[model samples]
Target chain A: MNITQLPFIKEIYGFLGHDLVAAVIGILIILVFVPLNSAFLVWVERKVAGHIQLRPGPMEVGPHGILQTLIDAVKLMSKEMITPKLADKFLFWLAPIVIIIPAIVCFVVIPFSPLMQVREMNVGILLIFSFSSLTVLSILMAGWASNNKYALIGAVRAVAQNVAYEIPLLLSTMSIIIMTNSFKMSEITAAQSPVWFIVYQPVAAIIFFISTTAETNRAPFDLVEAESELVSGFHTEYTGMRFALFFLAEYTNMFIAASMGAVLFFGGWHGPFFPGLIWFVVKVYALIFVIIWVRWTFPRLRFDQLMNFAWKVMIPVALLNLMITAIVLKAL
Target chain B: MIAITDIISPVLVARGAFWLMVTITLTGALLAVVPRNIVHNILGLALAMFGITGIYLYLGSQFVAMMQLLIYVGAICMTYIFAIMLSPPLELELPKRRKAKVITAFFVSLVTFIVMAQMILSYKWAPVTSLSRDWSIETIGQQLLTRYFLVFELISLLLAIAIIGAIMIAGLVRRKN
Candidate 1:
């Protein structure tokens, strides 16, 4: 539709108008995509898990269980809402909302295609991280509000694991920011024409991927929701749609993390063939597949082991990667 | 139908959206700290931080925004949750609000927000006249190595020390068990 040629562009260029219409349109796009994408991710995860276990997944639902997620979602919608007797009702109800808000908001700065960004701000990467942290807060709120011992333990483990991994995540990102100079995703993509940053800073990319997996609470880092031990983790007491929100946030976060990996390590939306958006989706889904693969392949790490890995191994490697990148860039 | 021209300018609309985001952030911050329930407070903090991330995007720092989501949403909030989980006593009673302390903190935060807002409103932010428009990742890399080499090196050293310290403290805690 030649969005660049839209009248909104001229107004933005003139610096005399507000792109309210465009902004609303952008927000609507995110609202639609998030729920839809999350639903699909659920189906994908189940199918992947089923295949790994050699079991038929969602065979009863439409066409090889394609409609299973939708049916489950509807069932959840109809189920009774339950609040624990000792729980703080207000915060308990509020937790899921908080978790979902950041998931939706972080997409504001994510550039889907060259012309399809909501807000092509200078600090897109930072915005995503800042908002994404709220999910953790929501997780904490969920655990606290549940008033369950297991939920509390799960929340504690989740937080510690998150904190331990965060340093390396930020450091690896810094290495990229140092390499790119610009915090803007658009600029970072543009900088990688002949060679992607993955080639220049392979170590940072590896650290980034690992840290992000931990960051998103995916396995082997899914200690928070470790089914065998913590039961259901932070959202243990949650039921119905409230429980679904947390589920939605997790999958959404997974998608966002994968998209970030695509944007950072792979040449986000950059390829020789097909459209930019297609390339972007391909890279993102490819990364998502790897995440699922890792999830099914590895046994969950103990909470202590998870924390130690981040503090001891990933952080040092990330720092060293940054240092080497700096030296190489200098020597050149 | 109303003409598209009747609506506010896109830039002004953007500003309005920005103000809306700011309001959401500030209000969320207030809610986060003032709520009697610690959990409510944390949610409020998350909302407020999300708002801040929006502001960062407005300020042209996407990397920082993503980092905000990754670290704060992914890490810090998780830590707060961990604290919540570990401290069982916190669930026994609602955290009592000290009126005097609340009043004082409110005044202080209000004053700070006002002063900061005033300063921002007052300042004439001049664009860097001769700076390259190329805000590419390569430029950041080049600058980090050539111009900001000391800072880069220091950051690495700082990260190294942080790792050692975190491990030592965590290990000590584990050993005490």
Candidate 2:
């Protein structure tokens, strides 16, 4: 049976398929943006790390080391992808793609400019949060499939770390959600026209930023990949292109976390004497810079310290912040 | 269950992408049961949940769809997989009585499917008004607090009572020790 020829199904698709082209175009833009943004961020992270330690980073690669990432990408792609003899081939291959997929899909809801959102849903924030959690599963799969002790240990840490941090992450965001009375990225941004949510929910903002940084597995939350202990954690067995895919996803996730924080706390794309997209980009990069700075300035927390901080410190503070926000909103 | 069928049957009738989601869901269930490996079974359950998230999207509420993903796939599935990773999988086989039970189960499900299909085929579906139906999060929130206020509060009260009872039991155990 030719299903597409079915009259009823055809009618329904006909009714709602008008946006198909536009949606494809939007996805294409995101596809192009993900890699470029990741590469640029990696270059910036290196440059930032270099200057912090008093050295010129990647200056030999190109003028000001701008083309360093491009060369690195080429080097990564050309390298042989080695699969461990004992590795579960199915899960090992699936992990990288699975990790990357949701990170790309998350771009659909993010508003780059007023007119530049891919697909705006009432539950855009939830969509991102939910998929972000899926990355934890991917990390576990990669670690377990590698059949390596270090990899499994790394993956285990990732799951525990993500599960603990996700509470404060959601709680902090809930405070902002209450203030705006909406979860749509556009609405969350628009609600901040008069004053940024950071002004009203500063505590929530701090927790949100910290939790998001942890969510992306950036330092001082990079215990998932704590080089000293786990030897690159869950990705110890990956090689070449497969490793690059994980890197690509990691950097892209860092941007998503930063941009989402911008949308929540900073007035996204809202600034004087500049376009919305420019303001949005500027805010994102600025946050990324701070994240990188924190990475260098701070040391990674131990496993117990990370868990206690999330449960005892971050969760309680975030809950208190939420209660206060709700009470104030009610009284006002 | 009957009311759910009434809601889903109309969307099910539009069988283009709907069928794709259905196939995915069936495949996921099959993977969950047919796999000898426990990890594969867990992942199959996750895949089925993912397919359900798509179906929820098709049913016109992105909120419900994301919540399905967030709660079921994200939290519950993660917990299951994590525990599975920690514990060893069982490999004991059942006795020959399983054949009879499988046959009976198949017949029961087949009869149920027939009855449900008959009901669906007999019913007249109303035209979808997705475009004209303009509802917001605010409206849903208001309805929950006003119309379903008792149910909402009662559920919260139930959770609170459960938590306190658990704590009370723990306190008694500690005191005895």
Candidate 3:
């Protein structure tokens, strides 16, 4: 029987019938997947970095250091939680929770498969953009609550970076939405069955990818949390679980952004041979690998340079791409 | 006198729940920006924005709701925190509200809200009867490229200019320092 047809599903169905049940299940899924995904990504990133640096990566700790992240997580959890004496105790505790809430919620509208999406909507693309922007605010909160000079500087850098990049990210996405018309992820994928948008709007695709990376605070664009410059950036004062929450949120966000790029430009869940869902995951992981590669390979852009690239380079390219796509589609 | 079927009505409960969420969101938003303590304001904003996301879910825009949380709560709020952190003035004691400023701002906001609300309520929203019922991502694409092509191009041009301007301004600021 199809999962949608299950009687148990009805128990948790309706607008308000068992929203609590739905929420609980949703949180459960996030909790299970986030840590597992973070572990896998951490291992993958290290291995990738190791190979690039010409050094042997982790060999011990459960099969080529696959268990390293788990060990680290345990160590982190066991450590004492610290709060600066000068900090506002209440807001300090609240900041991390605020960050994680959006990261988890973002997964809701993402179409993992046709049947796998938690909540499908007409405006899926807009939803993702809006929700992702909230991270800036949360980071700012974390920085302020820390009451540390480094944290403050990092938070300021983060705000400037996010605000700068957001324009290009939105513009590039607008090109896709113009080509597709609907903001729904599933619909965008369906439109690409005959031809993926990336084929026609390659420039937009590149802009989207770059802007998304910056948006997620990944390497090269990760000035907010740059260790060498800002001393761990905004979350410098955080310890134990609070810091873990920030880390988990960041990795999960990266996964979500990469997966979204797959859905938008790569014809989500569509491919010949193998199920649609399989194709979707393959594309997503491939993109994720590329992101990791970029992170390790490139030197970080200066904060000013980063802003300039987004506003001057990406935005214009994305706009021109959209215009060209629109005209071509119209003429055809 | 009670009807047996009345207890099971989903519509009533759904409507009630939606209004509750709306109240939570609006209240939270008010708290987020108005509070003297920057931290409290952020919390309030988060709560409010989360509520707005809930409202979006009800409006058949799950995607927008998710985006609202992700972008506003995750990113913008974080930015605000960073701003507070960076600003020395933020560390100062909360100032007492000036009665005149408070009254003027309140009246202006109230008037604006009422006017907008009235206009929205008065407008007639006509559904497109001839168009396909499918507002799926696929159809949106077809329409955007085929029917709304001009508008699409215009938006792109506008975005290009905005980007160039933002870069120039930021670059100038950095160079001066």
User: TM-scores for all candidates?
Assistant: 0.75, 0.85, 0.78
Per residue, candidate 2 scores C-alpha lDDT tens digits across A115-225 of 999788778899899998889889988998898999988888888888888999999999999887788999999988989988988899899988988899999999989
Question: Candidate 2 — which pairs collide?
Answer: none
Runs with alpha carbons beyond 4 Å of true place in candidate 2: A1-22, B1-13, B89-136, B146-177
When 1 and 3 are scored with DockQ, the better candidate is: 1
The lDDT for every candidate, in the order shown, is 0.80, 0.86, 0.79
Question: Judged by DockQ cut-offs, is candidate 2 incorrect, acceptable, medium or high?
Answer: acceptable
DockQ of 2: 0.26
Ranking according to lDDT, highest score first? 2, 1, 3
Model 1 TM-score? 0.75
DockQ of each: 0.29, 0.26, 0.25
Q: Which ten residues in a row have the lowest lDDT in candidate 1 chain B?
A: B128-137
Candidate maximizing TM-score: 2
> Hey, what RMSD does candidate 1 come out at?
6.4
* Native contacts recovered by model 1: 0.43
**Angstrom error at residue A64, model 3:** 0.8
Best by lDDT: 2
